[model samples]
Target chain A: MLEVSREMLAKGTRAGLKTTWELAKVVVPTAMLVAVFKASGLLGSITDFFAPYMGLFGLSGEAAVVLFSGYLVNLYAAAGSIMALSLAPKEIAILAVMLTFAHSLLVELPISRKAGSPLGYVLIVRMGCSLGAGLLLGVILS
Target chain B: MTVLWEGFLQGLQGVWTVARVVIPLMIILEIAQGNGLLQKLNRLLARPFRAIGLGEEGAFPVVVAMVFGLTFGSGVILNHVREGKVSPEETKVIGTFMALAHALIEDTIIFMSLGAPLLLLILPRVMVAYLMAYLVNRRNQHLSLPEGHHIQGIN
Candidate 1:
């Protein structure tokens, strides 16, 4: 019993370390990039352009970075952008749920195809569910 | 330079925040896996899974995905399909569920760090994935199940 617990602990620590390493690389650089964008006012213009549409989901236009980063890159990049931007808890919650459905689309989409699910079908379902949920959450929360 | 430094620090802080939650959860999950808790949990879930039309084979990947998220869970499900343990139809149904809700612990924890309420963050995906899977299972019988390699070839 003691040996079993020890093994679990060792295994867990290793797994955790691996995750930390992977996340740290993405989080730090993306967070830094977002900060630079915000400081340079680039994020502002971008936010203004997208605010109206993003507002439909109860998010500021700035929240688009998180969504885009999540979809195009991976979740850690999204997390970095989310932290870089200031948002209400409600907004964060909505984005979180949406990303949970559809983050890492670039990678996961292909993976889904390889797993024997029709590619287009899974893609539509994932993105459709994400956006639909985001809209619903936006309305309900507001 | 100042902005870069600030972003760097903030980024590291973000990593630290997530690390705190994820590290502990990973440890607990490892312990659970070691103790046969995952299998026991799977056994407990068998009836509920069937009610959702996932069947016994679907349950393992669902549980794996729920714990580890899509990337890990999808790999395991794919392997099962290769081994002929899970049919292509079952893989599709399972994949649909997993795509919506995998990595429950890690994803939820990270979002929680951003002040997302646990219920709010967790429920939407689970509910969406559930309904999606149920719908697919019901509708799948009418549709021609796509061959795995052909599906891959579409890319």
Candidate 2:
């Protein structure tokens, strides 16, 4: 019993540290970059351009960073951008819901292919689910 | 405050929020692993797996992917495929489900830190996975694989 408890503690601490470090590494830099964009007024124009489309999802244009980064990179990148922005809870929920349906496309697409599922089908399902769910959440949450 | 400073503070605050949630959650997950709770959960998944058209053989990798994440889940699927324990059609179903929703616990908490609704994350993802997998399986039921079709693109 004692040995089991000790092992659980050791495993937990190790996993916790690893997760924390990975999250911190991504969050810090992305947060800084977002700040820089805001200060330079770059974010404003970017937001303006995307506002119409993003508004469909009930998110600010700034949320494009989170969604696109999540698709092209990974969840950590998306999470970094998400954390940097000061969004309302509803906006965050919408973005989060969309991302859950689709994120890390480049990496995961091939995995699906290797698993013998057609890549095109995988893309359709992911992208379809993401946008469809996003639109739904936008309407319901907004 | 300068936007940069504000960004930094926000970053720190976000990190703090994530840390508070992630650290303890990770610990509990690890303990769950140690205590065999994850395996039990995997076993408990059989009913849902059946509802989604995945056989008993399909449940392990699906549960692994949900609990652990993509790479681990796919790796397990590949292993079982090689071992001849799971069929390609079933693997396709598993792959579809995993694509829709993997890494449930960790991903949920991370997003929750940013104030996303917890139910929105888990419930929809699960429903989508279940629906998609069942559809994929039903659609492909009549299609037979070519003889000796090895797992493709897995090198």
Candidate 3:
């Protein structure tokens, strides 16, 4: 039993390291990119544009970063962006719920299709769940 | 420039935070899988899946995806579909639920690390996924009803 557990430990550690490496590749680049966007003052304009729509979810425009990256890229990138921003706990919770329901569409949608779900159905259901969750949480939390 | 450097530092910080949670999680998950714990969990999950209109064959992949996330669970899920273990309608239901609620542990933990509320993140997603899956299952049932059967025959 001890020998088996030791082997499991070793295997687990290797898998852990591999996952960490994968997360780093996305998190680091996305964080850096957001920072550059902030420095260039472009983030300000972007946020200004998005703040109105984001308001429906009770989030500031800054959260557009998290939403966009999570939708197009993956969750790790969203995490990286969230790290760089200063959001209220409430806002963070809302974004968390929203992104949890829907993120990484470009990658996951195809997988759903391969599994026999239509691409349009997956896309619509995920996005609708995301936005609906955000809306409901916004009202309740606020 | 200093902005770029700052960005790089922030990136590293984000990676560090994630690594702290992810590495340990992977280790624990690996141990669980290695010990056949997942099979036990799968058995436990099979019953509850019926609440959302899934059967035994549909349970395995949904359980795997719920814990491991869709990308990682895709092999099991796709294989089941290809092997005709799960029906097309069941596949749609699984797809809907997994799309909303997969990777519950890792995703929730990572977000919790960012100071998001734990229960708030988890409960709503689970409920929504369940509700949506139930609706889809109902729709599919309605569509598949035998010509002579009334809509009320669904139960």
Compared with the true structure, all predictions reach lDDT values of 0.86, 0.83, 0.85
Q: Which residue pairs in candidate 1 collide? A: B69-B103
Model 1 lDDT per residue over A13-83, tens place: 88998899899999999999999999999999999999999999999899999999998888899899988
Which model scores highest in TM-score? 3
Instruction: Itemize residue pairs with steric clashes in candidate 2.
Output: none
Where model 1 places Cα greater than 4 Å from the true spot, the runs are: A1-4, B143-155
- Residue pair clashes in candidate 3: none
Per-residue lDDT tens digits for candidate 1, residues B44-113, read 9899788667777778999998988777788888788888888766777898888788888888887888
Question: Which has the better lDDT: candidate 1, or candidate 2?
Answer: 1
Q: What DockQ does predicted model 2 obtain? A: 0.59
Tell me the deviation in Å of residue A14 in model 1: 1.4
DockQ of each: 0.66, 0.59, 0.69
TM-score of every model? Answer: 0.92, 0.90, 0.93
The Cα error of candidate 2 at residue A6, in Å, is 1.0
| RMSD to true structure for each model, in Å | 5.2, 4.9, 3.0
User: Where in model 2 is the C-alpha error above 4 Å?
Assistant: A1-4, B1-6, B144-155
